[model samples]
Target: MQDRIEITVTDGVADVRLVRSDKMNALDAAMFKAIEEAGEQLRNDPSVRVAVLSGEGKAFCAGLDMANFAAMAEGGKSSEHKGGAKAVPKTLAERTHGIANQPQYAGWMWRELPMPVIAAVHGVALGGGLQVCLGADIRYAAPGTRLSVMEIKWGLVPDMAGTQLMRHLLRDDVVRELSYSGRIFTAEEALTMGLVTAVVEDPYEHAMTLARQIAGRNPDAIRANKRMFNAANYLSAEDGLMMESVEQDAIIGTPNQIEAVMAELEKRPAHFKD
Candidate 1:
């Protein structure tokens, strides 16, 4: 079988692409495992300063595979455990992978990465695909890209960390309406709704440019900022302020931090050490 995901790291930026273009990169059991493994690979590589995620072909992703849904409709098993063993039926409430289940981990892992992640979305990002995009710290979409909270159409909800991610990016009512309707929205509409950072002619190219810019910053500081921002959503104002100070204290006067200052004074591009 062809690899579901492909990763290439260059100049501190890991280019992570979903390679199942034939299926619009839809999530199947193997695709889920591949995504999770890709995230973990980048997490362990200290040399990676940033990541840009995109799909290989026409679409970013088309959400869950239709076969899985068909199986569900037929009341037949739709997935299996690793190593091809039959999967033991389990409740969604089960936390199989930290705070998420197998499916949720596919997207949530991107958010959990220490380095920044930027999603380059094009074509369609439906249901679970949108959830995967939401996991990124930032998202860029092509001008006519289509998106939706599409699970409702399949008599389901966004179970792949979409609720947790959408609540933070969009207003409560907006998220509720989208979830209830499962309506497809354009990239322009998504930008207005705060679902996308920008809608450009070429999202992947723009995302790579931004990724390279971010990769040039002091790696320690960048990672620290990601950590602080991730915690900000859950922390009180007092704790948030304290975290700022803590992260600053750890980064201040460090080798990479000093290099950043020196490069600025020298008027040369910063040469950051991963």
Candidate 2:
């Protein structure tokens, strides 16, 4: 609902775009709230089967706004929670938002959403920006797009769930080097590190193509797939197999599932209930 972020749903796909062109869609207090709320909207809206996240103007996001660092220099406490949130935590130990704090939720909310979220990344995705991209179920980056774990430059670590996501995607040494150096890397390098799914000329186009295809799928099956993929990272092999069966049981023979079967049998597109 925030002007900084916009959400438009069409054909069961939610297009979430960060619209702060003057700042290259940088993360500020309001931007963080907007991003978190945007994800929540997609999460709660049953009409949305998938989400495609992108940024307007020059970049996906240029990371934390410079004003934040200026505030720190001026002796004001510089943290991710800047606006609206009055009871922000003083430290990481306190849980301000579910399992993650507020800033982390800005990105982590995508993972928490039952449906798949695809990020179409271009321009700069640095520090918090990069972490936001990491939140998606998949990421597509334009060629030469720059990315970094930029918190180190400001004497901070990535507090936006980037570390946990990076551990799953990149090698430990790679994650360490990026976090330690805060060196910007290209989308090609991101793809090589598994940080990005693909590097293309136009990431938004690729992201939309995939998102629409995914949206056309049965919502129950798609949700089940997301559940399995999410559990894959944390659960053991035995538990994962059992969990898969449990999810299958919940989806199998359901109205939508049966519709999918009938559609395939009749050689037609499925008209699934959202």
Candidate 3:
């Protein structure tokens, strides 16, 4: 895990970063498993109220490693191999992480987290890197950041929750055009396409600012909100309203909610537990 990502927890905000600067944080076999392992930890950590995802060096990521394409060119699957042994869950179709397979979960697990996640995107976020950004609740991209749905260039389609996550963020035509062309678009273009929340000079600082704001909120209410918003994606209007009502009812009189009320009444900050 240390070879692939770095995770630090501070003041209820979990800072997660890809650490493979030499390769522009590109996804290789180890990186795929490492991301899944990190996601698993974040999923179970109750102290986390907010999270920020970023890359350590020049780029958020430059898509799949060249070795992955090499494997494809040789008509073999891309997976981890060590000491003449192969990892289990040998295929991409297995549901190894609840609703997603291991590779897909490397990106989708952020969506499954109970708290809000902000991605600080800079440099090139292409292919799988772009899908990882899509998994976040919000994305803050740096000015001039290069992003693309680049699977088409590799004779592929967007399979890493890009189809699932992107529908909520982009128009059908724009998604199709990007997918079809695999063209790298600027951060400004991503803003117009709604693929990013904001294009800022410093995406990391902006993301951290937003994360701290969210971390200050009542954690129970934050979790409740995440649930409601995620549910709204698949539920009908009538059903969505019903689900919202149920979630709101569950949160209205909770201990954390009461703390939020008292803090406001007393003009003091609130402290919440997971």
Q: For each candidate in the order shown, give its overall lDDT on alpha carbons.
A: 0.90, 0.88, 0.87
Please list all clashing residue pairs in model 3, or write none if there are none: none
The TM-score obtained by model 2 is 0.95
Candidate 1: where is the Cα deviation over 4 Å? Answer: 79-89
List model 2 lDDT by residue over 150-195, tens digit each.
9989989999999888898999999999999999999999888999
Q: Please list the Cα RMSD from the true structure of every candidate, rounded to 1 decimal place.
A: 1.7, 2.0, 2.0
Q: Where's the lowest-lDDT run of ten residues in candidate 3?
A: 81-90
Per-residue lDDT of model 1, residues 133-165, tens digit only: 899999999999999999999898899999999
What's model 2's lDDT at 256? 96
Q: After superposition, how far is residue 67 of candidate 1 from its true place, in Å?
A: 0.9
lDDT for model 1 comes to 0.90
Residue-wise C-alpha lDDT for candidate 3, range 146-253, written one tens digit per residue:
999999999898878889998888999998999999999999999998999999999999999999889988998888889989988999999998988888888898
